[model samples]
Structures are given as structure tokens and as C-alpha cells.
Target: MQNAITELEELTLNGASRSFLKETAKWCKFLSIMGFIFTGLMLVGSFFIGALYENLPQTQAMPFNVGGMMTGFYLVCGLIYIFPIYYLYQFSVKMKKALISKDNDVLAKAFEMLKSHYKFIGVFTIIILSIYILAAVVGIIGLVASS
Candidate 1:
């Protein structure tokens, strides 16, 4: 096993790649800020949802508690959105430091954060897709049962 191990090589960024990384970092920071704002809005809206439901008589008679469910949904969205935004923000910060200092270690860390951001988004996408599929199946079953 010792013989099979090899020494790790250092990664070097070309001039163009360095420029691209800087540009990507800027975009990531912008998008992360936007994401945080949206998350904040959703969280605040979750609080107001119950108030709206209390004031609206039509929602009171509904079979399901739309206000509570909507609040829960919004809270979940905000919680879920936090991860990617944090990761993107971290990537942006670390990438800027790495570029300015020309530090390979920092650059690696930045890329790792970038990976985390995409990984969270990819998993979230799969979960949403699965939920959609399940909902479609349930809808079809309901239609058939009703008929």
C-alpha cells in the first residue's frame, strides 16, 4: 500500500483561469446576497401568513390549514436556501483571498466551498423532483378513485 501511494502535485492557475475565477467570485457574491434577501423575505412572510389566515374568514373553513402549511413551507424553503447561499458566499470570500494572495491552499478551499454549493443545489433539485413525481402519482390515483 505504501508503494502504491504517490506524491500530490500542486495546482497552478493560468492567467485566464485566474481572471475567470475572480469574475465567478463576483457573481457568486452577488447571487448569494440575492439568495439571502429572498430567504429573509420568505421567513418574514411565514410569520405574516398566520395573521393573514386569521383575518380572512374564507381560509378558516378550508379542509386543510393552509396558513400553517404555508408558513411551514416558507420556513423550510428559507432553511434549505441557507446552505447554498452560505457556501457561495464562503467561496466568493475565499476565492478573493486566494487570488489576491496567490495561495494554492486557499484556492483549494474556495473550490471546495464551490463544490458544496453545487452539491447542495443538486441534492435539493433531486428532492424536489422526487416530490413532484410523488405528487403526480397521487393526483392520478385520486382522479381514478373519484371516477
Candidate 2:
């Protein structure tokens, strides 16, 4: 029992900073899980959209069937867009919890910064990926039109 108390003290006492890291770790695990689900849905949607585009006629935009499918698909994609946004909110909530608990202010601030940095990079990557996919689609269309 003494050892347990000692360990808990060491865990919380190493610095308020360490506790903040723990909080970030806890929240990031959840955000990462959401990211996984969103990415999977996007991958599946991309395949279906690709197939639909393949069947499209020249001079015709996507048909009602394809557009309808994509409309539903993008709604889920938008949810994916917000999945990481939830991480920002999670960071805010955890920071507040740390403040209310009178824990480490420095570490709490660091945790917020860390999550924001990750979120920024992730959003950038998503944008780049979207552009690449667009380019690929255009390339495929050019090839089909030429052939």
C-alpha cells in the first residue's frame, strides 16, 4: 500500500507537465481511433466513386445515380473532416479539466499546442491528398477521352 502511494505520488509529482502529457495521450488515443474510421470510409467511397466515374459518358457530368451516391458519400466525408475538429474540442476540454483540478498549467498548455500541431499537419495532408486525387481523376479522364 505504501508502494502504491509512492508510485502515485511519483506519477503526479514528476511535474504538472507529465500529467498534462498523460491527459493528451488519453485524448489523442480517442482522436486517432476516429481518424481510422474516417479514413476507412473515405477509401471505400473513393473506390465506388472511381467506378461510377468510369461509366460516365463524355460531355456528361456525373449522372443522378452517381451524384446521389457521392452526395451521401461526401456527407460521411464531411463527418470525417470534423473528426479531427473534435480533437481540438477535446484538447480544450482536457485543458479546462486540468485547470479546474489545479494541475500543471505549463503541461496543459503544452498539451494543447501539441494537439493543435498534429491537427494542423493532418489537415494539410488531407488537402494535399484531395488535390492528388483530383489530378489522378483528370488524368484518367484524359486517357479515356483520348482512347
Candidate 3:
């Protein structure tokens, strides 16, 4: 009877461990999705900003003020940037747990994706900042030339 009880306890413990692992995997998947979404949205926003600038009438474009757009864009981008960092932190925790459980495959996949995500954000920032600086320089030159 005692042997049977021990076996049952072991089974129960194993079940609980599996449940924990399942939850961790779900979180990993969620983080991956969020990373992809953030990257996509940033690219889309860049396109929208470009289109808006191109569509504006040149006559009124000289005194363009993006105070409102700049405020909102910065707020959204700030949140987007913070999210990946938070995800990478969470992934490190999850990967540690996975490694202890001998789930090295999952750890490898998650960290690989996390690394790619980090690079994606870096590229997005470089492109966006370049465009923003170029626009400002051109605008300043135009203002000075007109004066």
C-alpha cells in the first residue's frame, strides 16, 4: 500500500511540473508574437509618416509643426521599445527554467528569437532616426535659404 501511495505522489509531482512547463511555453510564444507585432507596427508607422509628409502641400509645408504627432509617436515608440526589453528579461527567466528541466531545445529557440527581436528594433531605430534627421536638416536649410 505504501509503495502505491509513493507512485501516486510521484505522478502528481510530475503532472505539476508539466503544467508549469506548459505555462512557460505559452509565455514564450506570447513574447514572440508581441515582438513580431511591434516590429511590423513600427515599419507601418514609418510608412505612414513618410506618406503624410509627402502628401502635405508644399506651400504650407514650410512651417510644418509636428508637435502633436511627435508627442504621440514618441509615446508609442517608447512603449514599444520597453516591451521587447521586458520580454527579453522574461525570456531569460523562462530559459533558465527550461534548461533546468533539460529542455534545451526550447531555450535555444526562445533566445534565438529574442536575439533577432533585439536586432529588429535596432534596425528600425537607425532607419527612423536617419529619416528624421534628414528631414530636419533639409527643413532648416530651406528656412535659411528663404530668409
Candidate 4:
């Protein structure tokens, strides 16, 4: 473990690695910007969902407020999506600055942001999968009870 830590401390980016990282940062910035735009669109659309659904004849037959529920669901999704996008954006900006300035602290922070971005995605995936599993189990139970 100590040897691994020592080797990690000694690690340095070669010219090729630096070039690759710079390219990666550019792509990350582009993707993050796109994500932000789409998320903003989703949020904006969420506000209009209720109005749109109300105009539909089918919505009136439903007992519950499907439009309001959909709006809230979309808003929640947009808010949850922002965190990873922001982290990616930060990583891209910090990485570019770090590469240009050769600043170790900035580079470390950039990597930290990248780590955060992936961590958030990983956790979100797990939570969503868990929800799916739980829903499946409940569905099975409901079917069994109905039979």
C-alpha cells in the first residue's frame, strides 16, 4: 500500500498524456455545456407540462393530477442531473487551466471534480437500479395478491 502510494506520488503526465488530457477536457466541456442546455430545456418544459396536459381531453378522465405529477417529476430529474454536469464543467475548466499553468493544486482539484462527477453518476445509477428492483418486487407481489 505504501509502495503504491509512493509510486502514485511520483506519477507524472508525459507529453502524449498531457495532449490527451487537453483533448479530453475540451470534449468534457462540450458535453457538459450540452447537458446544461438540455437540462435547462427540461426544467423549462416541466413548467409547461401541467398546462399542456390540462388541454388534453384524456387528462380530465384521470382521477389524479397526472400533469402536475409529471411536471414535478421532470423538475426533480433536471435538478438531479445538474450536479454531475456541474462537476464535469468544473473538471474541464480546472483541467485546462491546470495544464496551461502547470499548477499541481489546480490539477488535483480538477481530478477531484472528475471523481465527484463519476461518483455522483455511480450512486445515481445504483439508486435507480434499486428503485427498479423494488418496483419489480412490488409489481410481482401485487400480481400475486390479485390472483
**Top-TM-score candidate index:** 4
For model 2, how does the per-residue alpha-carbon lDDT over 1-147 read when each residue is reduced to its tens digit? 577778775545356765665676567656766765776677667667757765777575544566457656766665556556555556655665565575676446747655675877687799989999999999999999999
> What would the per-residue lDDT of candidate 4 be over residues 85-136, giving only the tens digit for each residue?
9999999999999999999999999999999999999999999999999999
Give the deviation of candidate 3 from the true structure as CA RMSD. 12.3
Error of 1 at 81 (Å): 0.5
| TM-score for all models, in order of appearance | 0.87, 0.39, 0.43, 0.93
Best by lDDT: 4
Tell me the lDDT of candidate 4.
Answer: 0.96
Candidate 1 regions with alpha-carbon error over 4 angstroms: 1-10
Ranking by TM-score: 4, 1, 3, 2
Alpha carbon deviation, residue 93, candidate 2 (Å): 1.1
Alpha-carbon shift of residue 76 in model 4 (angstroms): 0.4
What does candidate 1's lDDT look like per residue over 62-108, in tens digits? 78877788788889888989999999999999999999999888988
Instruction: Provide the lowest-lDDT 10-residue window in model 4.
Output: 53-62
Q: What TM-score would you give candidate 3 relative to the actual structure?
A: 0.43
Residue pairs with backbone overlap in model 3:
none
Higher-ranked by lDDT: 1 or 3: 1
